[model samples]
Target: MSTFRTASRVDGNQSTIVASLRRIGCTVLLTHQLKNCFDILVGYRGRTHLMEIKDPAQPPSKRKLTPGEEEFRRTWQGSPYHVVETIDQAISIVTAP
Candidate 1:
């Protein structure tokens, strides 16, 4: 099995969000894999959420999704997917009623 390590660009903001999600009782799975997929998979209260992580400092115009990511988003018919740039945004989506 290959070892898993955080992506080079995933700095403090991403780390904080992941930590907070776990603290709030959600199961957070980091999915930065070789395949075309979303960044994180969160399960809470029996619901699953697919999230794409983006840098908050990056301008929207510059934030182009990869072709693979675009394909996955287009084809995925599972739970609601989100593009979250901050911890609060992630928390809000994952904990929505």
Candidate 2:
């Protein structure tokens, strides 16, 4: 099984993202921890993908990434792990994985 998670200050965008993912046949898991951990989790073709979503208008902070997120990036270098800036970007990440 796969779990998809995202964080949003407002429920509108969050709900929209989750609904979009489901439309693409993804199972979305709305969580607080997974919000910062990763944007989404995708299980397809026997593989699992972890995603991170960020507002494009919002630049990446110099602050350190989470240990799990950092480890995920290192171990799955070739996979599609991205920081999404907009709804389009979020959809792109979900579709990529």
Candidate 3:
């Protein structure tokens, strides 16, 4: 039997956001497996962005960050991170001037 392990399940819109970012010449890396960390790392025009993907289909309250995610966000000392719920927001982030 193969020994490959599957990654954690991600938000519903994450794949679409990743594809959209890639289509717009942004480099997308999935980082959801990192415990208590952001979901994606995107690079564009010599800049880097960290994004946490939330499902838009869920209620705003339901989309709240998990304890781990909140802890990461609270303790992270890097540049400001973003939380995106839609393709447009993801695209806007990397494409913005």
Candidate 4:
């Protein structure tokens, strides 16, 4: 049998990010429960985006991606993937033309 470690599910920054996206006329879907998947699925202006939300307080060098996320990044050929460290960045990505 293999052991599994549950990923920390609480992200203090997600609420702000979701609010910011919605305020800018984007639809945001929280996918935090989907392990290794992007944290959000966003739609705007007839386009979709996959976003992995990261804590800005965490240094980039210390951030690590799960095996599933790695595979998704390497193999998926759908919407653009983004790593957003702040609400501003998330909003900018979804709103950018």
Candidate 5:
């Protein structure tokens, strides 16, 4: 279990990306509220994926993960973390074998 000391913020494009993933039959849970963690947990093909949804419209610097997020991703031993800037990227990740 991950310990969250603060609430997380959702990127502007997160909902759109999530909707697309659900349309393609993936189960998406909004994990963005977990501080220093990935924004979404995706279930597909009996596997789970962790995605950090970065809004493409944001500037590069703003889209980058925070120090805490970086550390969490680096140390996490469960599913690998993915950073996605577009809905297509998120879809491809969850759909890929």
Candidate 6:
């Protein structure tokens, strides 16, 4: 994730996005154990939501998930996890009733 850290420099943006989401009445979860975990767990009106956020500058790359994260994702089978490139995409997921 250091590569991503260098490319996007999104720590500030991520925090802003989280605050914006919270301001607009969305429940946001911040997890320290999981990398790229902020805004990862969001439950919509009636739908289960799972999303991973990345910066556009950091071109697509695959990385192996730790066993715990993998298991958590697997356990939440009903909701489809989405890899999102922007905050709007996350908002869409939350507000798509």
Question: What TM-score against the true fold does each predicted structure earn?
Answer: 0.81, 0.50, 0.85, 0.83, 0.90, 0.58
Tens digit of per-residue lDDT, candidate 2, span 1-97: 3343443343224556667767877776644254335656655445555655544444357224567667766777565665444567666655554
Write candidate 6's Cα lDDT for 1-97 as tens digits: 4412233223334566566667768776754335433335665555666765555655345334435446656776567876566678777767875
lDDT of candidate 3 vs native? 0.86
Model 3 poorest 10 in a row by lDDT: 1-10
Tens-digit lDDT track for model 3 on 28-58?
Answer: 8899877778899999999999999999898
Tens-digit lDDT string for candidate 5 (4-91): 6565667899989999999999999988877688889999989999999898889989988999789989999998799998988988
In angstroms, how far off is 13's CA in candidate 4? 0.9
Q: Sort by lDDT, best first.
A: 5, 3, 4, 1, 6, 2
For each candidate, the alpha-carbon lDDT, in order, equals: 0.79, 0.55, 0.86, 0.80, 0.88, 0.57
Runs of candidate 4 exceeding 4 Å displacement: 1-8
Ranking under TM-score, best-scoring first?
A: 5, 3, 4, 1, 6, 2
C-alpha positional error of residue 14 in candidate 3 after TM-score superposition, expressed in Å: 0.8
Please give the range of 10 consecutive residues that has the lowest summed lDDT in model 1.
2-11
Which of the two candidates, 3 or 5, achieves a greater lDDT against the reference?
5
Candidate 2 Cα errors over 4 Å, as ranges: 1-13, 31-36, 44-47, 62-68, 76-79, 94-97
| Clash numbers, per candidate | 0, 5, 0, 0, 0, 0
Candidate 4 residue-wise lDDT, 16-75, digit = tens? 998889988899898877766888899999999999887777776545666777788788
Candidate 1: list runs displaced more than 4 Å: 1-12
Please identify model 5 stretches exceeding 4 Å from their true place.
1-7
Error of 3 at 26 (Å): 0.5
Off by over 4 Å in 3: 1-7
Q: Which ten contiguous residues of candidate 5 have the minimum total lDDT?
A: 1-10
Best by lDDT: 5
